[model samples]
Target: MDHVPGGFALNPRFHRIAAVEVTEDDLGRAIPEHVIAQLDAHLGLLGTSTGYASGGWTAADFARMYQVVYAVLRDTGRRPGEVTSLHRDCLERVDGKPTLIYDNHKRRRHGRRLPVSESTAQLVETWQKELDALPAVPGCAQWLFPSPGQRNRPRRGHLNAAQFCNRIFRDWIDELIPDLVDEQLDENGAPLAYDRTQVVPYGFRHAYAQRHADAGTRPDVLRELMDHRSLDVTMGYYKVSLSRKQEAVRTVAALAVDRHGAARGFDDPLAYEVESVGVPYGGCTEPSNVKAGGGHCRIRFQCAGCDFYRPDPSYLPALEQQIADLRADKEAALAMEAADWVVRNLDDQIRAYSKSADEMRRKLDVLPAEERAAVESASRELRKARSAAAFVPLQALTARSPE
Candidate 1:
């Protein structure tokens, strides 16, 4: 078949088209945390005489080449063809940092330099030593990852790097694709499980994109890192998982939950009756309709420290409960390894809550003794109820370490 030059330039102006959009199969098939831990262990065993699984492929023997390939894919997000074309001394330090020069095989370009993470640079350095130790392929001295000593084509490098790397990936697919469905002669001779993950070599690249997206990397930056031709390709893998979406909804709802509201501001020296649905941080003197007409306040829930806010002594219990709820939310966010921005926001809100708590305490101190006592008693009762509601087993608790 004759090669078509500048294929992208050829466009059909005459015929209408319905291009088939390819759905992403591995939507959320990121390398699981457990699997990542396993990979780390596998990486550690490399260069050492340790038997890894039953593949008869140990680190000391056939591991170096595969390890280098895997590390490049993991760290650089380079394609298989690009990996095969790499040469020794590919490292180019710029601004006191290591960068890798990768050849863009798909684009038919030469020497595309990309800044690399420190850990990946280290991996490349380690792989360099192993590459040096291997016997040089007569005609392929420049190829960094030369094909392992072949019987006939000894001089030629990995003729098909994509296929070779794929075989290595498949060999380790058991650990990589633990949830991969298997063909079996079951009762129906078919499967019912959802093949959510793509059990292919490309999963590594997919995983790279997915991880960056989850870490909240911008599309443009991610595109540069992944070496994608279009932002749409990078974004295609930036799918929001159901759990993440649900967490987002819960976070927003938690901000807007029903809370005790004080009917009147504390500045009004005369005592006023506390309405059933009064907000505790009462600063809005605007008529309800007028307040509604203005767009919602960005810091609506931050009533405690608001300049126009007044904390009613009557709703001290509810105010304290907000603090407790914030503590719980902070714990939940940390447990989930929620985004850095989210964790920081929760921490900032906690600081804001502290200010609000101080404000409430100051107002209560000036209140009549009887009124102050009543608020204190309500707070104590609420604390006890909350404690009882969130009971943990004694067996789960261990004594704190002595300082």
Candidate 2:
């Protein structure tokens, strides 16, 4: 066939695009607390030994157990290819820190060093001893994750990332589903059935990034830890889950107020959901305003003076700044001999924002120190979530025209 005309044509594999179906929702979401609990419980049941080829458990199971747990603890968001391809002696003590020496094959970057926790280093040590003791299979001695399959391609014998995810990992999850409980609840208030689709091997990396983001890791630090070439990719993995957002919303709601700076009660969070239309620094409660995406404001965007305005402590800084700006504009209008209406408008805005700012500060000052700190933290999270790139307008993200 090699001698035939066009027999040396380019390999079809190079020409074909691989179409991998994404079977999960939000692949970047952290594994649920309950699911993580279930994983721990199940691993406890399986016992540590990688049983013989004749029965109970295999090396693959043990390798996966270590891999998943290590991935979680390390929180480095490494790819499965990187983990599965680790050499037998992948750990080193560099500058008194346990560092992992692995290859980022996908990026064509080899021998990358990552500082990891001592506990994770110990876990790797345990796996190394366990792998050494396990019954040897053909062509499997060199890899951290030796493939448990019978077919041996001696040159490339480690667990394939795709097979590890689609088969080895999926199979283990199947056995765990009956014992798994989801963080969500059904209409009957019962714990919902576990969604297996949510717990893929790759999602651990996403979870790692999220865990750090929630713990207030700086963006540049996170980007370095994630080993991404750019900050944009790192930001993609940083998401504040809906539950976190709701919690922040509830916290900020405690200090919510109307335009008059009077305290507003949102006893039921569900009812607060009705006032969903967001304004610059707060929310609009009027039905018309909410339905019109805050565009049809009854007070024409004069949020500080509108009865429907529901500003919380999160808006305090912006409100104070607005007051200062309005005052400056008023002075400028007075100096320019501007129309009475323009000067009066600026004066009214300054007064309204000043009243709101004073009320917000007064309420904040009276709270217990710990509660005040919590409110401040929640306000920060809420503000950050509001301005997250996911909500940015599409056109705003595009490059500006040369003109």
> Model 2, 1-403: lDDT tens per residue?
6576553466564457754423332344667555776776665433133343422236555555445544534355687778878877888997788988889886689999888888788888887787677666557667776655543223247767776676656766776335677767899999878777778777777777766665545566776787766455555545567887788778877678887877885765555667656677577788887887777876667888777888888777678767777888888999999999999999888888888888888989999999998888777676556545324434225452333
Candidate with maximal TM-score? 2
Clashing pairs in 2: none
Q: What is the lDDT of residue 353 in candidate 1?
A: 58
Candidate 1: which stretches are off by over 4 Å? 1-29, 43-61, 174-197, 241-244, 255-403
lDDT of 2 at 221: 70
- Tens digit of lDDT per residue, candidate 1, span 1-403? 2565444343454234744334433345555434544455566333233243222223454566666677777666676677767877788789989999988876677788888888888888887786667555566677766555443433465435754544555546533433444333358877443343344445566677766654445556777877765445565554444454333323221112121322233321122112111343332333342255323544665655444344443344565677788789989988999999987877776776566556566656776898666555443332232222333334335553332
- Candidate 2 — which residues are off by over 4 angstroms? 1-28, 44-75, 135-138, 151-156, 238-250, 253-380, 383-403
User: What would the TM-score be for candidate 2 when compared with the true structure?
Assistant: 0.54
Lowest-sum lDDT 10-residue window in model 2: 47-56
